[model samples]
Target: MKASIASLTALLVTSITALRPVFRPRAAAAGPFLTQVDNETWVIGNELWNVTQGRTYGVKLYYKDHDCVGDAVGHYVSYNGAASNLNWTSASIVTEGTIDGSSYIDVKFTATEGDMHWIILSGLAGAYQYFVNHNLPTLGEFRTLWRLDNTTFPNGKTDVRDEALPPLSEYISTLKVQDETWLKPDGSGYITKYDFSSWIRTQTYYGVYGENFGSWYINAGKDYYNGNHLKQELMVHRESATGDAVQLNMIHGTHFQVSATDVFPDGKMWGPWLWYLNDGSKEDAELRAKHEFASWPYAWFEDEAYQTRGSVKGQLVLSDGRPATNAAVFLGDSSPNKTALDQGSDYYYTGYADEQGNFEFKDVRVGTYGLQAWSNGSKIADVTTSFLQNNVKVEKDHLTDLASLEWQVSAKTKLFQVGDFDRYSYGFQYGGSPYEHGVVDKCPADLTFTVGSSRTEDWCMGQSKLGNWTIAFDVPKAAAQCSSSKKNATLLVSLAGYSTGVSSNVYANDVLLGNLTSGGGIGTNYTATLLNDPSLYRSGTAAGEWRYFEFPFDAAVLRPGAANEVRFQVTRNSTWHGFMWDSIVLEW
Candidate 1:
């Protein structure tokens, strides 16, 4: 009996110890341009930038406990991929007053060139470390780099580069360009949302090795604004593979390239700094080109070219077979674009039906998106953002059919989960925000569902861990006019456990849904949901096997017009049994 007791205690201890995650701390709120991650380094803004001429540089930084009340001294370091070799040099700091009404450090520094520069903010106890690159000359045009909530690595390394998802699979497809509507400048309008497929032609070019080792490929379907404030479609056929980078290049003029005087010896040097699309992925692509491929590769751009466009079109027939004109069709998805940037706005794309009940989405990007349509009598019909579900799958070089879109709004609608699809599989996107992710650092297996199974592996993660795990997707818009637009929306999580009960406080947009308990004895043997409570289980039916834990909410729980966030706060009480999260899905 004594030996048996010791063995039991040891098993419990091992299970408890197996669940902690090891990674950088995540921040809350919109990240400032600078975050003093540790006393040693800061995550500097590394957006599409190139310093035209070296001069006095300054930025507002987020520091703890104190504002910029005084000046301090610090050091700057340059990095080589070589972990052991680093060039550390001393630098000076001067304080500028807090801008606006926030507590931040405004540090001013003088530098000649910028190459992923790293610095430590001087302080008494834990002096803060920060990173900034003065390489981009246009200080006023600089966009904030690394979301304030993203990770700040040890050196001035980029979070995206360190964690970026693998390059999108290469694909060849056609881009579809729909019609343009000519409307008056005034409020009252008159025009057409017609399908003019292939109005725009695309060309592809891939460069092999040259004398300068400048091998590159331009696989983008190109276009410019036909008119100011013009909206059109750039469509691609959906690929057999899921989300991928859609390479797009929109240049201003004849200027082929530009440079960073901050990094070059003389002002006469030039580079591809300005030629590429101006967004957050510039320097990241540079680093990837240098290290990963040893050459610059194309990237996915989140935003459509300023005047570029794409559309989802189809006639909605009413119950009586009449055209449902003026009905609203929405395209929503939170999956990352090929460029892997989440601009938030990319989550919702909207279009309206013409008098013929023909609806078209004017501008959309590449990725898997969700769809919802609403008419007069009823509203909020759930649909997948795919070719089969009347949802538009926008790929490059292909045009989404203007007549392929269709939906029927109802009084109360539903969504049934299709388990075999990877659209529901998620660890986290490559180079996604650092705060949310698969527990790859601690539990390697918790990143995704087991092959052909809907539940997580029992040993995946958390013997006794606390915190939140969340997944987000574009929310299908509930009916705007009617109160009974959508009903019976529930989040399903399949879990299994042994000795202990691992539970989480389920939340949809911070509103409490219910407690999801795993590994605990259910009041009844199983649950009855519209979608099968199971996807194919690999384990047994006891406490060690998978059981359904659902978080049911009202139709109103769907947010107004953007991504719907589903978060799980692991607030478990230790019985020291085994527990794991298998599958999570939204079924209405």
Candidate 2:
């Protein structure tokens, strides 16, 4: 039988001692919403809905019946107890009754619409998959009730059918390590006046270094018309132990804000909606309080108009197409009041948009401002100034390209042996003899070797003269073991003894290997050389025995593929006690 390959050995070990997979609910990083042709039918949860605001988009909610008693005709009262056809906002107007005995409530707004960018529809009492469509919006007489009743749905409870409702993960997935997180404010954090005035302003941050940075305010209280309004800033903070990083360890919990765009009980506030959304609903308050991470309640995005430029505007999004919430927007260039556009200077201020992904630049000069939005420590989106037409002289408008950015996920490393938690007590010590072999004395009785989950007490070899102990195991020719992605691969090798610090030197066909160099103290290297084979293989402790001594070479020269021989070489210098090694896998 042929000796098993190194990659095969790694695979077998991993398989035999399979670790339970951790099911972490991550945000559904997806592609952004590409702008379809105007009025095209975009499908959300499989129910096709018409896009009304030209190509600019907004979500909608419809109801065909208010009460269970309605039977296709006759007038009925709405939840608000309104008589039926009372005009409210631009889109919320009660019109004639539908065959299902329900009045029509149209919701119309676009990403580019004025301050009113989004709407929420919460509190659908016992609503199931089947709902009635009373009418569709257009610019005609604006009065019609076309009922599409009893639309059967197979996965209504499990799938999200509304365009306004973000994915469950989006609402719950906290900013993970290396993932970007944009900061914004909850209106309740700051004190202010005016129920809905464009008068909110100011944002201040106290860095870890005791430095407080403040940015100019853009949109005022008027912009935060509904949902709990407050001045806020969208800052991007990285996650780290020493620096100012915003980490999503999941242990800290995800932070989000409730938006007016979400459906809520009537007469409720609107802002950014946040809470643990395990599957679909919010997380339990009692349990969440203990495990969930709370938003930085004191930090508020200013609700005051800090400044403004010549009609400059834009939007922001993540690389994965999700809206980059609460990012700070800034302008780079500006023009003197009524002066030539080219001769303008740059003015800068910051402001964040509401839940629909909007923002404003205050005190902005009239020329061209490099439109940049930042969240946490990362840039959300950046665009150049636009000067389209006369009426649109202020090139600032809806930014559609943001919906195309996507975040990339990186791969993680494998080897991890360097005494993970400082629990193992041992180190390298000096002995009187140089070539007479070192020694390891006084090993603790509780010493144990653990790989994956299998534990064993098979450690052999005495302590080094320096003091630290060691362990080694021969590759069982009868066993199939090892793994790797490389092709035309070869000899497998695994052994743990005393290293200068942490790691082993690997050799292949005596060519001097070149892989696994930076693999920390714990490393791996495989080969396809002879000496380690089957049918004509040599066994027992012979030439290859001394060929692989404990403390053979330095870690600086080890490589992966070209590695033929594996050995443990300890350093004679340093007062750093000693080190231990165990459980290695190698094959041919």
Candidate 3:
């Protein structure tokens, strides 16, 4: 009996010993097994763990708080490519822990086939949101914690684990411009980098070259105007294959100021710049970089032809003997019988008169040029007399001074005017944001305004699709009486912008004045479906140039010492017909 009992005890001990080995936990594998596939792609598993199609895999990201802002929350990850089933919202945080000194997060997702090309990360840190892109290192890098430092290297450099990466200039030197010259628009001529560079160097400006992630860029500095001006800066960029080339990219207006002269103010500089070129692939980044490098220190600036420049200075005075302050002056190629404003394929230079009405164009190319000037202020009377000065000669290293250019008014007497002549619908109702469809539909059907009592805001910004606007005024006994000796009254309608095939029918007391159409203006066909929302047209932003429509009518239409009405109705043609009015004027 004792031997049988001892045998049972021995058997129980053996079974317990075998089970103890199974319950003991094995040591966890040491990680981060990361391998870079390209600039933006990475392999996250060990060599034996292959990424197979239609399988599940674990994704781990190690993030270092280099800025020490705080731990980023609200993590999001996405798998890119057509084959990948995972999206931005698909992957969720499964676990969070620290690996070495860096914060690490683990996420689980179903693996895709060959179509899984990229992984993107985004999260919030303090008031700012941080984006981590495999391609855009400027935003942030997930691999090895690299960040951009411009002061250390030109074209920017990235540091990985305390090691500095090579600057973008080192890579850009290998690229070459394949075409001899790029064809200019309108089939006018061909343009080379030399042509652009030469013109750029003539202006006093600041510049810088930097890299954001894998993309390279050049900030050619802002224009003479300080803030929020149209076409303010000149910029060139070499974007990555996945980068958005259409979106305007901005930089600090003052941070990268490399020039001694302060031409632009300290603020955010807006972009789309002047030029944008894309790198077709990761390997093609160098090729795109070539254009940005070529413009820096613009080689053509060294040529004697570019160095030889002259200056043009002048003062503007209105016919009433008042200084035309803030008038815009332009210089264009000397073409006989052509105004500077009409030149299409010439180097254009612009300047503004100071408060004292004095203006000057510096570093102008040595050549004869046609000069044109116009007041920036709203005109009370018709200033239709041409200010075009033909064959204004400029010699090399000399100043061409034309003291006091006179601007004459076209009409002998002023009758009445509605809205300002500032070539914009800024002060009128809905003018501040008029780039939308269905604005005319929202306006009052019987829109009427009395001339003296009506404010600028009472006028609608634009008319569209058979909409009509009425202007009411009392005709004085002396001015309204028709006489054989008096000249015929003239009506002028100025448009800030318009759609194609737009026209207006003008009537005085139901007498047809004329069917008015745009003489010359910026025309666009907004083909998008009318959503009746503000975003239906141009996203509520202003663009394009002004046009004029004139009508001459007999003054007999006016009744002496009585109420008069001048009505304008858009000619019905198509659904998208429209025009933004700048001013309406009547003169005798």
* Per-residue lDDT of 334 in model 3: 60
After superposing candidate 1, which stretches have Cα over 4 Å from the reference? Answer: 1-308, 318-358, 365-401, 404-588
Best of the candidates, lDDT: 3
Question: lDDT by residue for model 3 over 34-147, one digit each (tens)?
Answer: 222222223332111211111222122112211110111111222221122223213333444442343333433322211122111112111101122222111110111111
lDDT tens digits, residue span 1-588, model 2: 012222222222111112221111112111111112123322111011111112211122112211111111211112111122212123221112221332222122222111121111122111111111122111101111111111111011101111111112222223321122111133121111100011112311111101111111111112112111121111112212212111010100001111112122221212221211111222222233232123321122122222222354555544445565554443332332221111111123345644545654432323333443333212322211112112212332332222222323112122222111111111212111111111233333222233333233333322223222222222222221232332232222221212222222334323333222112433333321111100001000000110111112232232343322333333232211123322232222
TM-score of each: 0.23, 0.17, 0.49
* Cα-lDDT of candidate 2: 0.22
For candidate 3, the per-residue lDDT at 581 reads: 63
What lDDT, from 0 to 1, does candidate 3 have?
A: 0.41
Query: Backbone clash tally for model 2?
Result: 111
For each candidate, what is the lDDT? 0.30, 0.22, 0.41
Between the candidate structures 1 and 3, which one is better when assessed by TM-score?
Answer: 3
- Lowest-lDDT window of 10 residues in candidate 2? 533-542
Candidate number with the higher lDDT (1 or 3): 3
